[model samples]
Target chain A: MTSSAMQQLYQQIILDHAKSANGAVAELAALDADAATAASAAGVRLAQSHQVNTTCGDEITVRVGLSGTGADARIDEFAWRGAGCSISMASASVLNDTVRGTTVAESEAMLDLFREMLRSRGTIEPDEEVLGDAAAFAGVSKYPARVKCAMLPWVAFEAALLQLAEPA
Target chain B: MTFVAPPPAPARDPSDQTPSDHAQTDQPLTDRSGSDLTLSSDEVLRIRNDFPVLHQLVNGHPLAYLDSGATSQNPISVMEAEQEYYEQRNAAVHRGAHTLAFAATEVFEAARATVAAFVGAAENEIVWTSNATEGVNLVSYAFSNASLGLGGPAATRFRLGTGDEIVVTEMEHHSNLIPWQQLALRTGATLRFIPVRADGTLDMTAAGEILNPRTRLLAVTHASNVVGTINPIDDLVAMAHAVDALVFLDACQSAPHLALDLTALGVDFAVFSGHKMLGPTGIGVLYGKAELLAAMPPFLTGGSMITTVDMQGAEFLAPPQRFEAGTQRISQAIALASAVDYLSHTGMHRIRTREAELGRRLVEGVTAIPGVRLLGPGLGVERIGLAAVDVAGVHAHDVGQFLDEAGIAVRVGHHCAQPLHKKLGVTASTRASTYLYTTDDEVDRFLAVLAEVAPFFGVSR
Candidate 1:
């Protein structure tokens, strides 16, 4: 008999996302190269951060592109490529989809909300209306070891954002 | 607490006793023949009672531990030995005129002698280090010291420059590989490795081509921690010696399961961790040839290791003392000696035979499951009672989680051998390893849990 904890941790949605992955491997590689080039060009700001969970060798390179300036600054794209467990991969896929078109401030707010939920240890009920597809990861909070897996992509996203905010 | 003596031996005709029971008599345990080594199923069940940690419930089911490759659980006797040392003879060894110090030094030196005998080395040949990582680093740093012209004429043989090469195997854990890599980088020497074959064994053809006269040293693992493939060390040692290159063996995985004899193996240096051998952590053994250790420069300096100092230059002691700096893990060393005693009493041949049977069962059982790929030597090959496997579509971490939910514990990921995993065409793998205390039921539970992993993740065909 499977415990409710195990069922919650490996939800059907997380499994489905991990299987499909959504982004093509070749396309992700191409986007990585394109992001690197754009980050070096004038007037187009891009930030890329590679995060690794040394414990299990789970890794991700997240690239966030920003267009426009100041309050009007918008997240043009969020792209990532890596290999990990279902929770980590699903969390990355959901993070890319949720933060693609939001403004800089809105993306920061989402990151903060996700971090808070993960730190709750299953106590904070996930707000699906706010987290969208990412809300399925609430079960991950119950496991301390899996928390790093769910946060790998988001931590990379935050690092990229911080790089974008730094003055040249 | 009242102490209870073991029941008296039953009176019977000497010829009627089985060889397994005879092993417990006055004869040397190592003298038992190969046919006498195999344990009955009932013996394995009885052996499990010695390890208290094995009796527990994890999650909601009986705990099945299959991660002994990482660290084996200690039996009660080993723990008691350490606690007794702390309670009675706790004092700084090799210092002072007090009775406690003399007693402590006696116990410490006794441990060194026991560990030396365990691996077939002289007491002076064994050097204490914090762990296996430090043991490897000690030798690597000696090479660096020789490169800087630290030890006199005797150390010149170890010196390397731009053209020299250090050869290692792809199967080495990072502990063995990274030190050589850094040494190469620091000394302008090239770092090379013998490629691993598809079966996870070393490629001797590549080894022949790589181990030329320019090769200053060759380091390899006796058995791989990831794939569980025991390398052909005799041939490799011969190849290294033919080129006048020194050889070092990483015995971390093999020391716990195999009967080790460093002198017989003909390696210049070897290292193994205590924690992995059912002993306490923070203590490890490094065995070097007597002459080589006497000539090599020290890695760490200060305290008891030195002979005299006047702020200009200092003379260091010989061999073991020169290498061991600062206060050592005295209690851990005692515990490790007790662990060695336990293993010796059980007879290494018997333990090895039992583990081989368990390993065969694990390999056969896990491979029988659908969508499972075994990474090491095939079913019939002789290995060190361990298996690393990759599922068809499920990541290793996911498989590990699924197994954990079923109360099975295993090591998942590259297992500190990322290069070997890449060579095997896998990002990671789940490994199930066995020690003497492991039972057939635990091995079966591990396989049963693994059978559910693919289906649980909806990846089954």
Candidate 2:
């Protein structure tokens, strides 16, 4: 007796992504967590951002590294480790796959679109051309509480990038 | 309904009354909480009808609100009481010269007297704060003021310093815990807590060691907002009093569900929020013993609380007024009195009896569901009508969303008790708390839905 909205919100695609995210935890743990603070002589650096949804106690930490500087900068390493609901974890997993090879500017644009889609309140159909698997979260916008759960990872991604942009 | 003010309760014990007497001689300190007068299923349905919001549908199914622990839904009478006041008797009280003003002040005092009588305190002993959080902060800051040499010689007992200790329990909501922690930080006193066992009951053996001579204040919840463990307040009050320490009960969870005779409870100070008890949001009550409130300095000082004013200084009014220092929550207070009337007319002991049955049902049902772990004391132990549980492999947020889709509204999170959740080895939990209006069928629906939770998440349990 699940409603259409609930099915749309927790689709098979999202559940699959969440299962993969749990599997990726061991791989994510192997990354140099300390690299977030220590930058080498290379112009690019690894940055990490830890975010929590205080309302529900969901927590996620995103770690990302860049391959170069300026316009040519490409996302080299993207990994996350956290404990939360399916929506948040699936979102992190989807974002990790979608943004890993894209340039930094493209990732930022994708994040902005994802955020706007979540705030659309079920009016704006998610542009899957940009969001990829992240588009599965379009139904989440109808629920103001769950929208935060969906956006948690992308916000962390932006924060990690912002940290990398800062003069190290 | 026209409200009548009850006579003020006399504080019978002397200021130096012995701790053992407060604990032992008052009555048998055993479990007097279990009342045999249970509400019938049809009577509960009638009670449910009184709450207009309970008859609604959400997500194409009937709404079953199990989040009364967060905020109880108001009955029709409580809502109408606030509306009637605004429509007919709206005026600024305690300062106006008009006829409406006089009327408003009279009704406002009547509300105070009603709430005071409900909690077994003198009318002058209750001070209105915005919420229970503000009430705790008010006392903490008043202690800070006293430590800084305010309230003159009468306030000397309120001071805390390097050697003083402020004790609290491990299960307190952050509203109760953080204020004391900050007060300790401000006054350089040591902050200690009596730990909770795996069963969610307070470790009384450890409690014996924690409450000692240096303990200046012992703040604990009358009942846990999370796990629904009703603390042994009589024994705790006795132990704290034995050390000559002040006791403050956070009755936010208890006052709404229990028959609270705060005088008989023997705590020095206590607080409960009005909204959780079916009143409006902007009003809360802080109950203190008459002498302690008389000696304490004001927390918020302004016009309504003053007696005389000069350019340099002003003399403060007594007790409640000294603490109430603004235009105040007038209609909210009236609405709260109406809520008190509703509860009193309904009978607090009957409500208690009904909730105990509901609590047992919740515990039994959830515990029977494989992979669901109940937080508080189990079957054969007494608790209020609530249960918080951790479902194996499914996150609480997901559980909440699933329940929402089923039109079963519940509270999901650490429930403002992160430390206790941490001690229980979880970041969040799903809590289903009931009130008098909650039906037996609704409890069954919750259990049925909860059984589907782990399986829906594809977890094998």
Candidate that scores best on lDDT? 2
lDDT tens digits by residue: candidate 1, A27-58: 44534556567665745677778899998899
How many clashes (backbone N, Cα, C below 3 Å) per candidate?
A: 0, 0
Tell me, by DockQ, which candidate is best: 2
Give the winner by TM-score: 1
Docking class of 2: medium
* DockQ, model 2, C-alpha based: 0.72
lDDT of 2 at B232: 92
Give the whole-model CA lDDT for all candidates, comma-separated. Answer: 0.86, 0.87
Which pairs clash in the backbone of model 2? none
Evaluated against the true structure, the overall lDDT of model 2 is: 0.87
lDDT score at residue B78, model 2, on the 0-100 scale: 74
**Using Cα atoms with residue i matched to residue i, what is each candidate's TM-score against the true structure?**
0.93, 0.92
TM-score of chain A taken by itself, candidate 2: 0.88
Lowest summed lDDT window (length 10), candidate 1 chain B: B3-12
